[model samples]
Target: MFPFYFGYFDPTYIMLIPAILFSLYAQSRISSTFSRYLQVRSYKGITGAEAARIILDRNGLYDVPIEVIRGHLTDHYDPSRKVLRLSEDVYYGNSIASIGVAAHEAGHALQHQSGYAPLSIRNSLVPVVNIGSNLSWVFIILGFFMGFSAFINLGIWLFSGAVIFQLITLPVEYNASSRAIKQLEENYIIDDDEVRGARKVLDAAALTYVAATLMAVSQLLRLLIITRDSRD
Candidate 1:
C-alpha cells in the first residue's frame, strides 16, 4: 500500500504530468517574454520606480513607499508593510517590461487600498496555509502507516486549505494585472503600442499563477483518488 501511494512508480504521479508540463511552460514563457520586452524601452522614459510612484499617487496611496530589492523579477506589494518592492531590473530599468511589472505591483497596492475581497481572503489564508501545507503530507503518511483513516482525513482537510488559497490567488492576481493595464493606459504612462507589449508581459506572468493553481488542484485530486482506492 505504501509503495502504491509513495514509491517512485506510484500511478498517482501520472495525474501531475500535465500540470508539471504546464508549469515548466509557464516559467519559460514568462522568462522569454520578459527578456524580449526588457530590450524595448518605453516612450515615456520614466524608470520603473517612477512609474509605480505615479500610479500609487494617482490612487491616493501617497504614503506607501517603493523599495528596490536585489533580484531578477521579484516585484511585489506588501499589504502589511504598506510597501511596494521591486527588483533591480524593474526598479531602475526604463523598459516596457519594467514599467509593466512595476505597475502590476502597484496594482496590488491598489487592491489593498480598495479592500479587494479576494486579496483579503488570500492574505488571511497565508498563515494557515503555510502551516497546513507543510504538515499535511506528514499526517497522511503517518495515517497510512498506522492504519488510521481519521488522520488521513485530517491531512486531506488541511491540504485542502492550500488548494483553496491557490484558487483564491487566481482572481487576486488577475485583478492586479487588469488594474495595472488600466492605470498604465489611463495615465498615459506608455504609448498605445507599448501597452500591447506591457500586456503581453503581464499576461505571461499571469500564466504562472494559473499553472500553480492547476498543479495544486491536481495534487488534491490525486490524494483524494488514492485515499478512496485504499479504502476499497
Candidate 2:
C-alpha cells in the first residue's frame, strides 16, 4: 500500500532560508547585470545569433545549427541534437547580454566538439538524473510515512544523483563561460569595456548555478538528518 504523508516541516526547515535567499540574490543579480549590459550595445552591433554563428565558424563548428526559441533566457546547447538554441531576444538583439549568452551556448558546442570530460560525464548522467528528479520525492515522502527504511534509503540515494549532476554542472558551466569570454575578446567581438560588462552578465548567471548546487546539498543533508532523528 502507498503511504500518505504530511507535516514534516519543523525547525530544520529554517536551514533552507539561506539557500532561498541566495537563490533570490542570484536571480536579481543576473537580471540587473543583464539589463545593464544590454543597455551598452556592442561596437559592431552584431546580434546574439550572429555572435553564435561567428563562434561556431571561427571554431570550425559550422555544421552545428543555431535556432531561436521563444522565451526569456531559454538559451542552451542541445548536445543530443547538436544545435544551439537561443532565446528570441538573444537571437535578434544586438546587445552585450545577448552576445554573451550566445557565445556561452557556442562554448558548449566547443565543449562537445573537444570532448570535454565533465560534459561527457554530465551527458551520461542525464538519464539517471531525469529518473531521480521525477521519482525521488515520491519515494522519500511515501517512505517517511510508512517507516520503510529501504524506501527512504533508496530515495536519498536517488536524490544524490541530482546533487551530483549539479556539482558536475558547475565546472562545465564555468568552463563554457570562460571559453565564451576568451572567444569574445580574441575575436574582437566587443570592445574591452564591453567585454567586462559581458563577463558581469556571465558571472551573475553562474551565481544562479552556484546557488542551486548549494540548495540541493542543504536539502539532501536536511532530509538525512530528519530521517536519522526519526529513526533514533
Candidate 3:
C-alpha cells in the first residue's frame, strides 16, 4: 500500500484534490494563453502602458499614474495610491495580450471612480482577510486540541470572511474583463482576430481567479466539517 497516495482518500483532503487540480489547470491555461497572445502583435501597435493611458484619459481619468513594475502578470490598479502598475512585459508589450490586460486594469480604475459596490466591499475586507489568514488555522488547531468549541467556531467565522471576499471578487474580476473587451472593440484597439485572442487570454486569466475562489471554499468547507465533527 502506498502511504502518500492514501492521503487522497482521507475525507479532509478528498474535497481539496479537485480544487488543487483545477488551480493547476487554470494556471497552465493562463500561462499558455498569455504566451500565445504575447507573440501576436496587435494591428494598432499600442503598448500596454499606452493602452492604459488611452483608456484612462478617454474616461477623464488623466490624473491616474501608470508605473512600470517587475514580474509576470503582476499588473494591478492600486486604488489607495491612485496608481496603475503594469508588469514589465505588459508595460512594454505591443501585442493583443498587453492591450487586453492594460484595459482590464483601466476598468478597475473606472470602477473606483464610479464607486463600484463590490470593489469597495472587497477592499474593506482586505485587512480582515490578512489578519484572519494569519490566525485562522492557529485557532483551529488550538481549539481542536484544547476542546474549546468557542475557538473552533471563531476560526471558522474568521475564515468565512475570506470566502465571502473571494465570492465578491468574482464579479469584480469578471466585470473588469468584460469592460476591457468592450473598450478594446469600441476603440478599435484590436482587430477581430486580435480581439478573439485577447478574449481568450482574459477568459483563461479569469479561470485562475475562479480556481482561487474554489480553493478557498474547499478549505472553509473542510474546516467547517472538522469543527462539526468535533462538536458531535
**Candidate closest to the true structure, highest lDDT:** 1
TM-score of 2: 0.96
Encode model 2's per-residue lDDT on 1-232: one tens digit a residue.
1221255346677778899899999999999988887777888999999999999999999899999899999999999999999999899989999999999999999999999999999999999999997799888878887889888898999999999999999999999999999999988988888888889999999999999999999888888877797789
lDDT of 3 by residue, 61-122 (tens): 99999999989999999999989999988999998888889999998998999999999999
lDDT of 3 at 214: 100
* Model 1 C-alpha lDDT per residue in residues 95-175, reported as the tens digit of each score: 999999999999999999999999999999999999999889889999887889998999999999999999999999999
Using lDDT as the measure, name the better of candidate 1 and candidate 3. 1
Residue 99, model 3: lDDT of 86
Superposed Cα deviation of residue 100, candidate 1 (Å): 0.4
Candidate numbers, best lDDT first, in rank order? 1, 2, 3
Per-prediction TM-score to the true structure, in the order listed: 0.96, 0.96, 0.94
Candidate with more favorable, higher TM-score: 2 or 3:
2
Off by over 4 Å in 3: 1-10
Q: Residue 140 in candidate 2 has what lDDT?
A: 85
